[model samples]
Target: MPDLSLLDIVNLCDNCRVHQPDPVPSPYDSERLVPFYLSESPDSPVIGLLRPVIVEQLKLENQRSRDSGQRELWALNVDESNFVSRRNRPSGPSVSFRDWLDTHTKRTVAMKELCERWRDTLLFEDVCGPKKWREELYPVYADPFGVHDHPNTAAPGQATNFVFEMERSACALFGVVTYGVHMTIYDEVEVDGEKTLRVWVPTRALSKPTFPGMLDNTVAGGIGSGMSVFETLVKECMEEASIPEHVVRKYTRASGAVSYFYRTSKGWLQPEVEYVYELAIPAGVDPQLFEPRPSDGEVESFELLTHTETIRKMRQGLFKPNCALVLLNLYIRLGYVTPDDEPDYMKILTRLHGTFDFERW
Candidate 1:
């Protein structure tokens, strides 16, 4: 979602007033009531709702949404400032960080132990450590322990350009993240008459969520929604495929962002950013069967799709919208299809006519 400030909304409302008739009072009329309302926050029942409402309305107006014209309404009844953590608290009595670490290091399950130890070490009993404390743990647990830093830290000099949409009652903006991945396999197999290459996608899972914004969007500490493309891929690989570190770190052909899209969610067309990456699996190993995931309860089933099969599935709308774009881009990269290498849809639509871009929620 895009963000807007109160002044921005005032200017917009002013513009709306110019083109359309003022029905009741100016939307900014509440601005005049804020100072008085805040003064009575201690006991005024009306002040409790009214003061936060004014501030939140301003926040909503400033927020980035898919719809520019309608995003203002999200302010209506939202207790925007009351964000609470849904994380499960530790069971049993709290212990010192060092004590927790001593206990966790003996545990057999590495990921859970590490996470519990980390939470206790970082957030328990006022560690009083600087934000940079996370950097110390990065090398220790980042990949192997599933305690990795998110790609929320954008590289210096990088800037984001937003895509905005307006709905009847709300609006949002599209934000993109640059992402890359490489897949490779090496093994020997018999060809027509002699030993030959059996190039295949070595990844165990074919359809796991990879993009960032597809899951969560709350911007924290300068990180916006759709910020963790690499992290998301890493997470998916870990949970769905059990891909090892050596395999993930293996160098192979790196495909730049081939293309991307935003599927407007249904009902008011809430906006969402989407991204795609393509990589070739080097010749040799046999493709692995993806086991159905239990930790990630949402995974249905996984299957390997050949280049031809993947394209057919994309064309048939059998894939999720983001997954479809990923498959289409993968097809183009593998020479199963050709695209203009531009991000715009019309160019590709012109090249491959009678196509459909699936709308996702």
Candidate 2:
């Protein structure tokens, strides 16, 4: 929220106490020229952090004036364009997105190599001493989601935690994506016999565009953490699924199973925050009433599935990998199915693509 930029850091470094300016005779030959030096407000927070070396740098700049025979030889000028993004018209990083992506690609490749080396070191260390291996090599190989072991031996717990925390912070920008599940119960005339609970999925649940040009092939994606969980949920619901603004507000309830995720994508491992909610449908409201609105034309078809049929569909990989798992868990947790009823979670297992795996903490 602060208006500070990188220039503020650079300028702070440039101006030092040793750089006081010296007076010179005016060219007009009447009055002596008063040497000017860079100055800033005393109340600025940045002023306190200035090290002695920075002050010395500033002093050198000030002395340069008299040597160059100029009064305003070393002046601090705040760059106006330092903060703005060229493509997006926002003020942030100096590097362009293309450049940033390229750098990320290189980093990802390097990290992959580093992870491999760490893995090899760990394997070698494991043969020597188990205790030494855990202490020395595990910390370095650990992943953010705790998938890998920490390879650093110095301080195993602290070092791994530090790395995981750092990795989580680095990739937090991509945000979260989640799916909502709903079921409509249709009853027959009989009180005990033939009733059906039909599961309905929104055509467009949550998604971000991977390619603007190939909207038709675009997958459902959501930007998480940019807004609060509920805010993001509502926004994504509207964007991908075409949940009517009023309808979403009306049926949405806080079902309270918030889960935390640390996701790696595009070479950054971001923190993903998400929660689930279930809203009761009014008696008159039909599940068929809602139509799927594809975000990037990713919707194949929308159909209602019964409990047994849903499980069968899961086995056939009708949904996204993680999405299928999430749906299966939701169904089991919500009592739509029994825990003993193990649906084919394998259907949800798909190779993760387009996401960068973080090896470095």
Candidate 3:
């Protein structure tokens, strides 16, 4: 409900500047500053956690992509000039028609209809009509701009939650995208009288509808319709980690964010932005000693792993895809992983943060 969005996370970084032992240099030109640094290179691997076939779909919005300081967005297999092809512009005044209704437009026909509607519907060929789509998928489409206060959620001035569905959110078609927040609860550990690092990782509940028995961040949750980014972060910390409000308010730092356009194994177009955070536990509390009693049933258990162990699990693909990217980003910022360590470090960083149209938080 508040004006806060992931965009505000960029401002949180200003407070962190003085505390950073080795701060990344800020360029004289405002365009080059890193709220989260990213290169506007299409050839750069921006979409992590997706298969190569789906990743190749990332095409330049314009030949001048490298020239645009914002690198505003990355299109998937569509011409840049065309409005329908834009990745995150769902509310634009446009519509593509279809004889069959996989999902009907309740209030606005233009919004319910999409550019890649037919292409998206083909994957669900066995299913039919908007009513059927709702019956089957039961997607809780989210309003990216946080329209929670709007009295009539079903037909608010903005598009309803349906816009976030993969097919409905198709870049070259629907153009809407979703957002969330991810936080890594970390602390400095003393092993063998030497200083090291340890991170708290959560194993998702096996009963979870998606990615059961997988790994996740210390605390993570989606930024749903009408909820502000900070609100979601605080709420998730309490629910997921049982982290107290005082601790979260004092130690948590809004590090940065990552965005990506992914094609799920289930065949949906998922474009999302994840605002990242770092919460350092007090010296009196040991990460391993604390029990993460998940208030929500989403997490099965919690394990504290050292940096080496974390990377090993990452290589094995134990963590959920996006969570893995978030960890990799944390490692890079911590200087645990560097450009020299990987051949495509620069590209990895660019794609890891993603290309977003949103201005700096």
Candidate 4:
């Protein structure tokens, strides 16, 4: 059953206001889908490592949505700062970063490990020690495209944007940043003589630390050190979905990216970029027929859902943060949601890209 009943109202941000739609009986009706609430984070005081311009750029995106004059966009505007995360964040741990990052002083176990490890490796220095550090047990995240670069690093401070530890990246220490890929998979469906889309949604294994047991894109993995974008996509596809090399190479197509500075539970910053892809699972065949289990333990299972149901669950805050952003990108690019459908269409486009200055990187 769709969660549309409860999802009828949403927020662009906590402070943004809401206008409810006329209640409709049939959940699938597109007319009723319009005028729903959207949760978009608004700008406040400067925080983390982002510059005022970059931060304002993000707020402008939300401002467009808020400023939309009674457009029939999905999701209505709402008020107050409480319940902010509920608008977009997939259900997870309690309100941690959205509230405590400003007040909390202690780091979580994983974050402490990252901090200690970074202190040992001279993360702030430009010495050759970084190379030797990579040989150790630490993670090395390389941002070749500099997609995670930000403008807050001070003059003459070009972003090294290379070799980050897994724990550190998770902790967002010293304004450290990283990149990854999120591929959304879908199959074409002909429902009642009309063409529609059904997405392949993956459930993350409950053992994972972040957003465990939450819904995710079909295959999403960090673009680890030394791998190109396509390389990471193919590797993740095989591991997470049991997709073959041939299928990945032929079926996976780049679908741009969704970039944001996500605030995680442990108070670590995530100035991250998720290079998005759309993998079209051939209509007649899926990985299940050929592979009985996932090559990796990250994913628990895969389920195909209609686009309506997918969005409905997403509004219910069931999708992982990055996963939800990736899905929104797909919705925008596929014409399922349009300028008419979204009041802040252009802002949404700009904000989703989360463009960073490559020249400084």
Please name the candidate that would achieve the greatest lDDT relative to the true structure: 3
Q: What is the lDDT of candidate 3?
A: 0.52
- Candidate 4 Cα RMSD (Å): 16.4
Ranking by TM-score: 4, 3, 2, 1
Please provide TM-scores, in order, for all candidate models, with all chains considered together. Answer: 0.36, 0.37, 0.56, 0.56
lDDT on C-alpha atoms for all candidate structures: 0.28, 0.32, 0.52, 0.51
Q: What tens-digit string does per-residue lDDT give for candidate 2 at 10-88?
A: 1211111111221122122231111111122121111011122233433564576568884432233224454332222
The digit string of per-residue lDDT tens for model 3 on 185-278 reads 8777778997777888999998764578988999998765446678888888888888877677777899988776443443333556789998
lDDT (Cα, tens digit) per residue for candidate 1, span 162-273: 1111111111111112122322222334546764322233222234223222211100011122335454545555554455445444522334432232222210111122
Ranking by lDDT: 3, 4, 2, 1
Model 1 misplaced stretches (Cα beyond 4 Å): 1-229, 251-253, 258-279, 286-295, 339-346, 349-361
Worst 10 residues of 1 by lDDT: 215-224
Q: On TM-score, who's better, 1 or 2?
A: 2
Displacement of residue 268 (Cα, Å) in model 4 is: 2.2
Q: Lowest-scoring 10 consecutive residues by lDDT in candidate 4?
A: 9-18
Candidate 3's C-alpha runs over 4 A off are 1-175, 284-291, 356-361
